[model samples]
Target: MSRKGLGLLVVCLMALCQPLPSRAAGPLITPEEAALPPPKGAVGVDRRGVTRGPKIELVSGSDIASLPTRFQLKFQTFGGATVDLASVKVLYLRTPNVDLTERLKTFLQPAGIDMPDASLPPGEHMLRVDLKDSDGRAGSTSFILKVAR
Candidate 1:
């Protein structure tokens, strides 16, 4: 084989050996995470500081019937500030709380998050979405995801 052809073959082999991304592997939330106790507080949108913070809107239906459901969220900033994407946090509301930011990072966007396929264990799962604005104002929102038994 030509030298260039051999190099290309080697690169393809290396790529095949790499593990697939989490999104491709399976569900984003595990059974254990879903079974944890809910956080101590009301479940809804909240804002911190006199200045308004960023907003997280759940574009998809809050009630999820089955696995591999479409998950969509939109972000909005206020008070002449922009949404601080880096400050975004997706927490599985529980006694200890599970951070799902890393798993959902790829789906995140400046305007919102769009996950064509997402899965969670069967139960009523409460998720807390928290983020800040460029001005450092904090905003939070929580919603219950009801997965069919």
Candidate 2:
């Protein structure tokens, strides 16, 4: 072979002999991390104070739950932005006499967050979440939950 061909062959051999760099191939946030409260033990905010609203990502919980009181739902945010605390709203509504919006806020986790004290009776309920970013952008999401006593 020509000198160019010989040089190329040697380079390829050397590359094949070298060990590849190690890179993490795991999910950014694990199930355990998602189970934690807001900030949920994961990094979301930047050095700057600005943060974008979270995009809700459902993780767990089913249409029906054996105990609404202990029913668990998992969620993750889209943007790598810290949620606006003042603009964060989580509402749990049940017909006839049930609204747990304000009450749940006190026990919310970060993206992939969970309600701290969610004890409710058997019933069908609607959960609505509204969030606002530091830039004044808004996003909303919801889900239907059926709790069984």
Candidate 3:
């Protein structure tokens, strides 16, 4: 074959040998994905060590109509493990429909925790906690909270 014809043939063969483009594959599942199951054995306890079961409890004075609210959440877990907690997110949603995410952003800014801000108003709000561990293990929990004022 002539030089130009041989070059053209080589180019065609190379093109045919190339692999076809494919859609990006999904993310790989790591070992952590198999280890951390849904937050099993979840229980909320009060300061007095009283188990509240799997329910969100509001303090006596935690009326939605009140202002400047403060509350705490308590849970237990076995040792011999660690969590990054950097990916933890707390979403607060108020009833009757109001998104205070931005407001909560400012509230959490000083804390320096890289978490999603709440998008709810002052009232009975739902607290959604999403967490991913250092090994990529993931778990989530949610509870109702009264955001006073």
The RMSD of every model to the true structure, in order and in angstroms, is 4.7, 14.8, 16.3
Q: What value of lDDT does candidate 2 attain over all alpha carbons? A: 0.49
Task: Give the best candidate by TM-score.
Answer: 1
In order, the Cα lDDT scores of the candidates are 0.82, 0.49, 0.39
* Candidate 3 lDDT tens digits, 12-78: 9999999985422221112233233334443333333333222222322224443323333332222
Error of 1 at 84 (Å): 1.0
Please rank every candidate by lDDT, starting with the best: 1, 2, 3
* Candidate 2, run of 10 with poorest lDDT: 39-48
Per-residue lDDT tens digits of candidate 2, residues 48-107?
233354556545554545432333344334455555657766554322223344555544
Which ranking of candidates, highest TM-score first?
1, 2, 3
* TM-score for each model: 0.74, 0.48, 0.35
Better of 2 and 3 by TM-score: 2
In model 3, the worst 10-residue window by lDDT is 25-34
